[model samples]
Target: MLEPILVAARGRIIAGVLGGAAGVVVIVLLVLALTPRAGGGTVLVPDETPAPRWAPPADPPVAAVTPGPYGIAGLAEPAWVARTAKATGIPRRALAAYAGAAMTKASAMPACGLSWTTLAGIGRVESDHGRHGGSTIGADGTATPPIFGPALDGDGVARIPDSDQGAIDGDTKADRAVGPMQLIPQTWRNWHTDANADGREDPQNIDDAVMASANYLCRASTGLDTEAGWRRAITSYNDATTYIDAVARAAEGYRTAADR
Candidate 1:
């Protein structure tokens, strides 16, 4: 699964993100950005246990994804972020990216059945919400110093020759996965986003990385509300049964924790 990309912020502020309320003022110029009966996911094949446990997360009323104070990151309900952050222990900043990305997708791909909790579940598994190795998610939603997976050299994982030529992964010898979503250079090229409206589609940016992950899964599977669909979509993201189940458990936990 992640062995290929299984590896996975913040930073210092990005150069373009002006200090203070200025960035909020700039967001007004930006634009907006699955599933099952099992709740929210994408793909094929039904689980032995279906529908109930994997049901789509509780439907929170999402604000319209319009120009906002923090680009798409502002779309999540402030109250929801506060309460859910306490319940799930997700950093408010990263939680916003997860929730806001789902809301942005809602208007664009309502049929996809994606949910913020599902995204959080992936975040927990991917990079502990970008907290791996003590990294932080900047206010602008970028991961500092960036994150990279172990080199894929066929030692125990798939061996992929250099693709980005040391650009994205910073490795000219092997193609290491980059970003919180752990997308390899080749995969990142296929599904990239600029949800933060920074004009750059950087995988290191959680806003971009999370949205890109949603794009990849939504495109991979028709829907993710059912066990079959969720499993399929996760499998596409990481072709391992263990990985699929891990995401399911983590996502389900977030959904349950938030609802409480």
Candidate 2:
């Protein structure tokens, strides 16, 4: 009798344990059903906004060119200048100045691989090829209204204090970038050249500015034919990555447009 009772008890215990386990499983299922799913049955994604793209300015008709002391014989306003100006939207006069400067630099340093497109790229970024603020390029490769950057009085821009004593930029309080290339007074003093052959190194003249910019870039690296050299040269001009990218894009645009 005792054995039968013990057997019955063992059966009850097993059933109880199974019942408890079933209760736990039911509770887990209920909890899972009550829990909220991620996104509420919807998928989520990160932002997919693209970076900003920079474009060259409109190709406006430039006035006729007049022979100047700085004019090079073989470099005299090529047909490609007008063609590229018309195609890439760069000013004809600006294109001529850039091309002449690049050609001059090539003659001086044949291994530099300096191209008009690169100078044009810098010009576009510096001051829209001297067309920024309604300024126009003259036959002598000078900006009509003259382009000047904001005063570098330790503001958001550089804090370079008056390096030229109000002579080049006319600001004694702080040094401001002058001309189409946006060159500081000190840089102009160091790299200034008289591409116009007028016996004076004037930053206001596009011929001089373009030549100076080209020389500076060529001196920065061995050759700009490779991306590393090109990047180094441009970074020496301006360390900002955005500025470099904008210049590269503008240069590529000019190249592609000119090819077409």
Candidate 3:
């Protein structure tokens, strides 16, 4: 009887010990399964997946065009014209009038290569475009006589005769500094060619003036496109340094504007 009771007690104690050991094994397994894995060379663990990558769009390209010869002047704005006139120190209205006159005359005679800007500059220097009125006397008792004769022709047109005698001594005071371009009687004689279909040489006529100016420039210019040639041509138009500078500046402005 004593031996049987002892055996039963031993069996109960062994079973309890086995059950406790199984529970501990389950707890350890749960902890390991729930824990997160870290990134490493040998870890072989899953990490936050990287966001899907995408490419950016590109911008469109700009196209450029080549311009024609003397295109700059064609693009000349009013502001540019005004600015150029201001830079030249010439009156705005006077410059415009002169430019317009030259343009009209040259266009009428397309063969004339004289640029309107060059002619305008010349007009400014010569007779101040007939504004000076051939010189005048001051308020004082001094007679400021005419440096040259009249600017109007017989028909009130600007006229300069081709004859040497006429140049030296013309009957009409109006024959003095012919047209807006101011061609003198003698100078006009040298440069005159019947550009227009007119029967005789007429320097005072705007048509004649424009053609003469063009011819003179071409003759004086060794190379029309060159800076040096421009300088020589402008200087020949009037021997004054001021006149040359003014014309050169105006020409440069014209070329730049036309090119644009």
Candidate 4:
């Protein structure tokens, strides 16, 4: 399973002002804490732009779609989904998965404060919302051909032996991160879910992967409504400071785009 590391370690905060970010500051970095593990999330440096402490992304709508896993896609209204997808440049199917996952998390764990924008940030960094490698997200939320990360063979990446016998990633020699969230086979096997309620839980399906991501994230951090908490949560997901910062930037960009 994806372990949540509570990083209270020491690190440098590279401050930079995002042009056209419209008053957003990122703080709470977990540098070199719990990195190089099996699964991790995947930051920037520029002239310093004076800004206040980091602000977590605004909460997304928590309107319920229905009572079952199948309803996850309907968590957001059609028109709103379309507009927000267009605004944020996120695919409609991917946006639905991310938004629905957030809404579901909001209802399931109200205090976690998991935002769809943050999920989008992850999807963007992980697999481009299941659109990476020329693969497309189907209406059912499954990524065609699926997505897999580079082999973890100790070649410029974390070396993890083949854990699933290639059952999940199709690579028996070494384990590879799979699906939109880029979860390793070991992690997926431990935390996979059936968000689509299709009777079978899959890592390739955007809905399932997103919900699994939400569950893991919420479990990693009790609350993500604050800068320090959000940073810790992202750091737990991926120990690299760059990964945390990149997710923050992507989340801020999504929120900014949605408002515009």
Candidate with the greatest TM-score versus the true structure: 4
For every candidate, C-alpha RMSD to the true structure in Å: 12.0, 28.4, 47.3, 10.3
Clashes per candidate (backbone, < 3 Å): 28, 1, 10, 1
Give all TM-scores, in the order shown.
0.77, 0.72, 0.40, 0.78
Tell me which residue pairs clash in candidate 3: 71-258, 72-257, 72-258, 72-259, 72-260, 73-257, 73-258, 73-259, 150-173, 152-174
lDDT of residue 72 for candidate 4: 79
Model 3 — which ten-residue stretch has the worst lDDT?
A: 25-34
Question: Which lDDT value does model 4 have at 99?
Answer: 85
For residues 1-260, write the lDDT of model 4, one tens digit per residue: 11112232222222223234222222222222211233433212331443223336655854544542355777787777888888888998888888888888888898998888888887776666776556788888888878776676665445678889999988999877778787777667656789987888999999998898887778667578888778767766765654666577778878888888
What candidate 2 gets wrong by more than 4 Å, as runs, is: 1-69, 72-77
* Per-model CA lDDT versus the true structure: 0.65, 0.60, 0.37, 0.68
TM-score of 1: 0.77
Q: What is the lDDT of candidate 4?
A: 0.68
lDDT of 1 by residue, 149-210 (tens): 76766675556778788998889998776777666777676667798887889989899989
Best by lDDT: 4
Can you rank all candidates by TM-score, best first? Answer: 4, 1, 2, 3
